[model samples]
Target: MDKLTIALPKGRLFDPVVEILREAGVVNRELDDDSRKLILEDEQLEIDFLLSKAVDVHTYVEHGVADLGVVGKDVLLEAGASVYEVLDLELGSCRLVVAIPEEAGITSLEELPSTGRVATKYVNVAQEFFDQQGIQTEIVKLNGSIEMAPLVGLSDMIVDISSTGRTLRENNLIEIAEIARSSARLITNRVSYKTQHQRIKNIIDDVKAVISKQ
Candidate 1:
């Protein structure tokens, strides 16, 4: 009957996850992120939330700093963190794609050269993907503004997550390859999963129930 600490990504996925938590009866009151506080507590429920960047959720759970976490599949792939993926929240749905500038005249992954430069924050994903296709690419890691790389000739293409094609269309980028689909995932610390089995399972069931209705 101990308190459980959960790591939640603090970005676009935050609101949706919070809504699920509320609907699942994990928290009694409405949760708000527009605050200076990094941790939010629900004393009655014996739950504490660690609000963090999307990329660090897996790390915290893997290190046991958090018993559970909500993160994206893209981050889990890029970070290669060791944690049990308990459930797919299915929020923040998107796709990881390889895109090239419209002027490149490349219509598919087959049309691209054997060796080229790719700009992406997901270096591991990009490397693994191209290697599987028998193509070699120099992955340039850029934290943000990945679309700008191809426009300025910094890279031949980009491996990025695109929720909608609008951003790519605005930047004149066309997706030629889809590496993977991504969504919010629930992950648990290995040891914690066993040590706090029922408590964790209760929340998982609650969340799953809420998600099934959506």
Candidate 2:
């Protein structure tokens, strides 16, 4: 029997998703996040687990290396990958927002200068949001330390993720606008959906039952 492969993101959402797979009877073994093994196979259940960085999950799925991928909604929007975004797992919820230094006090984005500079890893999403709002800003792409950009005067604003707002507050920044609310999502490769319809549908149904109870 061919093993069904599911790609799971390596960071925050991994353990809970692994637990969900267990509860759904898709896999019968406990997978360790701390383990060095990136790929784990469950012989009894005929399933393969592909553990990878959160950002690359979409790429794996798009290329059919993974039949299905569990990743964040932000990743899908940022990567703009061609895959079926089949379900939202409702795990690791967060918001992508437009944030400016707290010292530049005002309640709304409108109160800020129309032309400013923004920093973020989400270039495409941020560009679209600002354009829609008629705000013209130079966007700088940063891989990390997005909050520090505004504090250090590298940019006047930042488009980044805020989970509890604690990080922004601690860094003396305030969220001016929310671009999107995101959570973990289930995505499937186009070809895999057609080739492994029954197997994939069964798992989706099983996972849905677990989520519906919540």
lDDT of 2 by residue, 93-156 (tens): 9999988888888668779778989999999999999899898989999999899998888999
Let me know the TM-score candidate 2 reaches against the reference structure.
Answer: 0.96
lDDT of 1 by residue, 1-214 (tens): 6889899888788898988988988877556666678888889888888888888999999999999999999999888889999899989899999999999899999999999999999999999999999998899999999999999889999999999889999999999999999999999999999999999998899999999999
Residue-pair clashes per prediction, in order, are: 0, 0
User: Which residue ranges in model 2 land beyond 4 Å of their true spot?
Assistant: none
> 125, model 1: CA deviation in Å?
0.4
Q: Can you give the lDDT of residue 7 in candidate 1?
A: 91
Alpha carbon lDDT of residue 72, candidate 1? 96
The lowest-lDDT stretch of 10 consecutive residues in candidate 2 is 105-114
- What candidate 1 gets wrong by more than 4 Å, as runs, is none
Query: Top TM-score: which candidate number?
Result: 1
